[model samples]
Target chain A: MTVSPTRIPEATVARLPVYLRALNSLLDSDVRSCSSEELATAAGVNSAKLRKDLSHLGSYGTRGVGYDVEYLRYQISREIGLTQDWPVVIVGIGNLGHALANYSGFSSRGFRTVALLDADDSRTGELVAGLKIRSFDELTAIVHEHGVAIGVIATPAAAAQAVADQMVSAGIRSILNFAPMVLSVPDGVDVRMVDLSSELQILAYHEQRKSTLQPDDGVVA
Target chain B: MTVSPTRIPEATVARLPVYLRALNSLLDSDVRSCSSEELATAAGVNSAKLRKDLSHLGSYGTRGVGYDVEYLRYQISREIGLTQDWPVVIVGIGNLGHALANYSGFSSRGFRTVALLDADDSRTGELVAGLKIRSFDELTAIVHEHGVAIGVIATPAAAAQAVADQMVSAGIRSILNFAPMVLSVPDGVDVRMVDLSSELQILAYHEQRKSTLQPDDGVVA
Candidate 1:
């Protein structure tokens, strides 16, 4: 079944992968089918929200028997476009880039790190995750050779915008940026940033609230 | 002035950091004051939402003159508890852990990585980002000595739960998980997960939609 992008909300689209992961775990554990509540708990979401999200993809579970684990997995995977492999390139082989290159979850979810490119001449020819690091100048050539449409920027904040400019010029349509900086890309190019510091800051805000509310109930012993 | 957590919505709390970051950038560039619209654009948010968010913190921009950049920065930093240093311990010193230790953003904010713990004996005594990787058995001692309340779990999915359990037992109330698995933490403890593959999958979903909608409008060269 083909699903149109307009039919699903962006928030629902983001949660689709979480649901897919939970479904995959169920399938791995030999679970043939699961109710909406069961799937929601597995996905770390509430049942009502899970049902509403699945309804966007036309995946309402059976009234009593619930959802077929394998069928649901395939549907979610196809919806997230994981059914086809996506050639991805990492620009900047720093510590963060090294971690991204070594991440095994990428391959399982249809992302293949076709090339690891770095601007530093010293890092060139170095091997990470069995792949040789290439020069940043080779970006265009490598993108063309591998049909890489997604580029991951793990460079420092100072170099992020420049790297993004290079990626855009090289025709990368999607970018996953790890740099803690704002990147200005062309209109058509999509950029999603994962700011480790921002995540920690948010947690600190809540943690601060918790401490203030219960000063005597200190956890730090 | 201390702002009560109950006064602000969770969504507003999440966006406060973005606003603070934008203000800091303006401060760095010597922009003393900015209208809500200008600050909103800098933060990649809309003016109405920005105004509403800041209102929760009792930070209303002066009529025409706009907000005092330094004042807003101080308010946000204080509200998010960045004024105080939070001792943090990272468990599992692998590549991702290495990236976390090397991350300069943590120290710039409120988090300080006081110790790095690993279960493997081989990784112990090794230095990462100038800090020695200590044995996992030293977790309690380090947490107590450093007054660590935040724990980062960068271990593999197989070991995330065990690491989280140890962190909880060692008095860590906040956790930033990088493992690609669901971690079951007890009540009152907050967990924020950063799944790299999940983020990529979301991007792939949008990318797939773009390609399908305009099959001949290939950006890849």
Candidate 2:
């Protein structure tokens, strides 16, 4: 049966992935039910916040009881469109691209890396974690054959835009960009950046502030 | 003179890195001062939210006059511990680590990838992005000599834990992990993970939802 759009908030949508991971971990342990507090604790979030997040998915838990681990997992998974497999293409077989190619998380969910493409002829025939690097010319054919809608750009900053342009032309509408540059995608396409140093800089900012605001903690450590 | 303590919320602390990056861009363009509205917009955040975030660092901006671009930049840089360079050790000389070693952001942010350590001796003599790879056994000595407090674990999931364990023994307390596995760090140490596929999976969830909800948005091409 088809499901209607529930109009979940962006904030709630972002947290769904976290909850889903936690649920899967719990399921691995054979957990049948989990209270909001329990699941939230395991997920490294507050119970109140966890319940509020789940409320966006139309109240899957009871007031007195908690939630069935598998049921909630299924609900969130379906809502996230993970019930079906998503074939993906990776452009730029550099260091970051190699890591993405060998990444276990992609294969964990229904996401699969259908092809690995690189413009460099030297890397084209090299084997990376079992997948032989292919040339960028095969992007369109591969995407059409694999029905790839998700494209990952792990190329260097200089080549990011070119890869993104080619991806869009090949009917790739969703892009996960690792290049430390701002990508301007068209209206229908979506781009998400995972900047490594940026995340560390953020942590450093907090650590810096913590050193000042809580002198005792820093000194003792 | 030593700096006094100042309190900053965890959420605000996280966004400080983003603000710093945006401000640096503005500075490179020779922009002097910016209102919360302008700065927030450039940083992909709202004015009110940005103001609230800045407020945590104690009224750095004038109520009506906005913030001095250079002063705020310094404040944020200092807050993120960039006033002093942090020496980091990368345990993997693979593709992602190589990109990071050559990345301009780290060199600019007072962070140096002091040494590249790998488990394989054959990968040892090879130079990547200018730095030569060394054995993982060198992690402790290099950390001690360079006073490295932050370490990056870019090895495969199977080897990430051993690398982290060695880092801790070397007195490194902050870690930026790019491995896909869940890391269990000892108390008092902080670990941050960047999973490429997880980010894509998250974006895919949103992209799939968007396509299903707005099927009327035809392929313009």
Candidate 3:
């Protein structure tokens, strides 16, 4: 059965990589198959939602036997485009950018960091994770050289939009922005933000709720 | 109007910070008021969804004036518990930890980095963003001294779970994990993960779709 990639909802698409990670962990543990309940637990989602997400990829595990771990992993990997190596360029060799450049998870999965570019001339020759920090002027050359489609922006918020504009003009369409700003990109481009402050704020919201519900717990500071 | 925080759904709770950031940007730009559509555009969400989300906080703007930027900002901030400073401890002083420690967005928004703790003895006394890196054993003292409730784990994947255990023992209840592994915490403790690689994977999924739909675009490498 063929599942159209366009038909998968955004939410389901977001969850596929998570499911793939869970499946990979299972494979590492020498597990061959697992039930929806087990896979869902590994993915930190409920079984019903997990089943629904998998169904979107035309992957319905056998009723009693559960899913074939390797097979499902391949399906999700293909669906998420992880089967092909995605050449990625990291702009801005700041602390966050340095961390991202050193992050082994990307290469361990399917992302290949082809180049690290920075606007500051002083940082141009700096080596981060074995890759020399190139000049921002070299973005177009690097993108075309590596056939890069994805760009990671770890520059400060002030520089985020400008870096994004460069990435767009260089023919990159997918962006993972770590800057604490809202990036305005064209319709065809997809920008996903991973804001540290925003995540902390969300945690604070839940933390506040816990205190409100148990006022006498005396956990408040 | 008093809105009960408990009633807001998890999905809506996650988006409140984004809305708050958008409102802050508007406020910074001297925008006095904005309709649902304008705020939604700033937040990168549709107007209906933005309206529904704001309604959960009882923030229905005037019929014509839309939302008062300052007032709605305060409401969302208070709702997300950003009204008061949250004392946070960051465990790990690696590249990612350094970036997080230097992240100005957190302090600007309401979270104060009270202490930076790491298990590496050599790292102790090193200054990051003006805060001296302390030994991991100081976790308890720092948490109690600062009345800290949120802990951030930027340690390597191998050390994440152990750090989480120490944080839990030190009475920290909320965690924002940046490690590339799954963390298992007991009930009453909240954990949110920020996976950089996973975000790229999701982008690759959509990028793959675009290529599939427009094969003649010659975007594929």
TM-scores, one per candidate = 0.94, 0.84, 0.95
lDDT of 1 at A130: 97
Q: Which residue pairs collide, candidate 1? A: none
Mind giving the per-residue lDDT tens digits that candidate 1 earns over B1-221? Answer: 55554557877877877887788789889999999989998898889999888888888889989899999999999988899899999998888999999999899887899999999988888999899999999998889999897899999999999999988998888999999998888878888888999889988987887887765655321
Give the higher-DockQ candidate: 2 or 3.
3
DockQ of candidate 2, scored on C-alphas against the true complex (2 decimals) = 0.41
Candidate 1 chain A worst ten-residue window by lDDT: A212-221
> Highest DockQ, which number?
3
lDDT of 2 by residue, A42-85 (tens): 67678998987787776558767789888899988888888888
lDDT of each: 0.88, 0.78, 0.90
lDDT of candidate 3 over B49-89, digit per residue (tens):
99888888888899988999999998989988998889999
CAPRI accuracy category, model 3:
medium
- Highest lDDT among the candidates is held by which one? 3
- Name the best candidate (by TM-score): 3
DockQ of 3: 0.65
Model 3, B18: alpha-carbon shift in Å?
Answer: 0.8
Sorted on TM-score, best first, the list reads: 3, 1, 2
Q: What is the TM-score of chain B alone in each candidate?
A: 0.92, 0.92, 0.94
